[model samples]
Target chain A: MPKSLVSLLIVLLSVLFATAQTKSSSAPSDLPPGSTSLIDPEDLLSELQSQQGEKPLVFNVGPSILYMQAHIPGSEYVGATSDKQGLERLRTRVKTLPRNQPIVVYCGCCPWSHCPNVRPAYNELQRMGFTNLRVLYLADNFGVDWVDKGYPTTKGQ
Target chain B: MRRIVLVIVVIAIAIAVYEAARHSSHAKGHPGAVDSPAPQFSLQDLDGKALSLANYQGKVVLLNFWATWCTPCRGEIPQFIEFQNTYGPQGLQLIGISMDDDAKPVHEFYQQFKMDYPVAIGNANLAESYGGVLGLPVTFLIGRDGRIAAKYVGATDMTALQQKIQSLLQAR
Candidate 1:
């Protein structure tokens, strides 16, 4: 066999092996630790829109512009990083949310590691036994990645 | 026809400028009483007695929004208890709005902290009336006159609360 042909075959095999390893990994990216919940943004968006006529959809954590600049349309506003008032607003809303429907939560307050808002929301939902929970790991803040992706977003709170 | 077109263009430009100015006015940092005039609410205590902001009309009130489960809120509990006891006689009333989902935890926390101040479960109407809570450990200082004197969103230092109370008291 030609030397170049043998070398090319070896390279192709290595690439295939690497791709297989990544695919079989136990973890999925964009998820925080202890997250038993996962859902796609596209799925979340569709669910959110469908529920809009029946209920106010989506919950934005933190006081970041992600809630104000652009968010899933018809979403209710709650600041995870603001003051006690903000959290109270969230609590009231949470109590009223239907457990059967999907509730998508995101926050730009912190990256996944040190996020104060998203962690609590995720844990709280689990405690409440919410079966359908979607957490969007906005790489960095929402403005840089989520909105910049040209995803559907609405202005104002 | 040419003059009418010119007039319409000028009007559109003027309308656009006005809209831009209006949008900026409601920006996050617009200031001036963003969180104040706490919502009026009446909640029954664990004992089934009712209480509301209107009940404390003549005193300087501190509507401290908190949850027993919130670590930062708990961290400030000791100081809050102390501040209330020290300043209580002087007319500073610290009203705690507990946001705990379960009353058992709230009861345990109250016992552990020995909180003398009154507490009530939070509700949406109350939250909305007080400009809505964006996060935990929110403290709103209400003056005797009924307007919101100052709003503290996070865990606040006892000293800072004292300073705010002093000025609000002096204002009278």
Candidate 2:
């Protein structure tokens, strides 16, 4: 009922509200600043389907099992970037490409917050000076975000 | 009086936001599988022992596709170990299919967690057989009759999953 008590309560409530917003938005916190390197599933699908302009080289940086089950057609499997070997393979794959080449990487192995692959791959590419890299934002996983959405996919090695 | 009302409103909004975020992160449960036959697979466990779906026939099976590197999958392991201990005698068989690229971490995880279920390294074929396991922590509940009962994707609601397992165990 006191004015001071009300002011304290308001401050506490503001902190709580701010904390909630931070936690909810933490899913993309691992991404690059501004999350400008991220691409939505729908946008990537449109780009793939349009076949207009210079086509980006799409890479699957998740597990091979998921890649074999379903993946964006024509996306090269770079293995799980969380592993040492997978990272090496990714570097090898892109070593010859121009630094400015349009590239997209995705790892729909789990939720966006939990994916252990994409961040590493994205960081590696960034360190390698790739300016045109984009990480596909699969909020859930591939099955729910892309494959289940009826996006074009092909299963195989 | 006005301050009290403002505090109440703020509290209510905070609670709403918390609940909404919690539910959104919880596993998305799929509609019950149309009683389709459970996909059969024979694989070798960490100990190189034969682990097969047929081995658990006539029992309620909780087939979980996970990987050691998967954070949500790791979160579910302890609860699953408890489930196996509590429900093993009740015809509940918890089987794990690790989708990890290697089996070494899975082996370590198995011992560290004291997992009571049979976990085998999963392959692309095995994943595809179950309608494509394109994600981590995908779970399938199979009835005693070897038919799929329910499927859950992402981090599941453990309470609801336990209840479902109980019902399935009671069915036969």
Candidate 3:
């Protein structure tokens, strides 16, 4: 089979898997409560296109290099949640924004299951009572889901 | 007519750029086995100099893949620094392959740790060559002969690492 077809299959599988997780009786078990509001890649892309003025604040809680290479347009880097400085940056970033402001967090440096940055960042916002938070499901990485799709991308830190 | 021609030209350029970027982005499969020869790479160091793996041949090279954000990687750096101090003159070469994307934070970490070795920006391609470095603080010990000696996936033991380096340094 062609490589493109295989890649599309993998992306499709990732989307399906992320959607399936929403219906699981139990959460990931390891992750915290209220961490399952996953924003599908297609859905997020569409939202970015349609919503102009009231766009949600997107945060790339991944590594600096990934952000520098490419990132969802308008997303801010608040450091890696695995680090003390990162968590503090997140805490500071959320202070000015309204508690109900729509927020999406992502870190496609690793697989979603093993990503050290996303969950902690997600849970931290949740602990702060930010109900309008969602995770951008990056089963592979940002390059595959977002960048490869020709979505809005901005490089440089 | 001119607008249509312009559109076609733009699309062609876009496709060419996309294909080129995609082809250069990824490498095929793993870089090979531990016993096999190590991949030669030139990566930018803290001082913006090119540090090459092959440049350190004839010395036992400790190629460490680490991130500033990783807790275990922080703990392991002290040992590496100590090893470099003790065995650097004895033909042990330590190179840090920082998994961090930004050099600013790593520079601060380097100063905090007081590291004396060269640290390069690590990429997925290089990590995958060492049999897929999925975790932090993964290290590869390269023999003086330029073949991989051992690959450690987590926080490396000081005593064991020292012993291995000692043997490699003394081996005829």
lDDT over C-alpha atoms for residue B38 of model 2:
82
Task: Sort the predicted structures by TM-score, highest score first.
Answer: 2, 3, 1
RMSD (Å) per prediction: 14.5, 7.4, 11.6
Question: In DockQ terms, which candidate is top?
Answer: 2
lDDT of 1 at A42: 54
DockQ, all candidates in order: 0.05, 0.38, 0.09
Interface RMSD of each: 12.6, 5.9, 9.6
Question: C-alpha displacement of A30 in model 3, angstroms?
Answer: 11
Query: Which scores better on lDDT, 2 or 3?
Result: 2
- In candidate 3, what are the lDDT values of residues B1-172, reduced to their tens digit? 5565587589989999988876444333335356678888888898889899879979999989888766667888988999999999999999998888667889999988899999988876676556445445678899988888877755678789888889999985
Assess the local accuracy of residue B51 in candidate 1 as a C-alpha lDDT between 0 and 100.
Answer: 79
Residue A6 lDDT (model 1) = 74
Candidate 1 accuracy as TM-score: 0.51
Return the TM-score for each candidate structure: 0.51, 0.82, 0.54
> By descending lDDT, how would the candidates be arranged?
2, 3, 1
Better of 1 and 2 by DockQ: 2
Given candidate 2, what's the lDDT at residue B57? 94
Prediction 2 TM-score vs. true: 0.82
After best superposition, candidate 1 residue B30: deviation in angstroms? 12
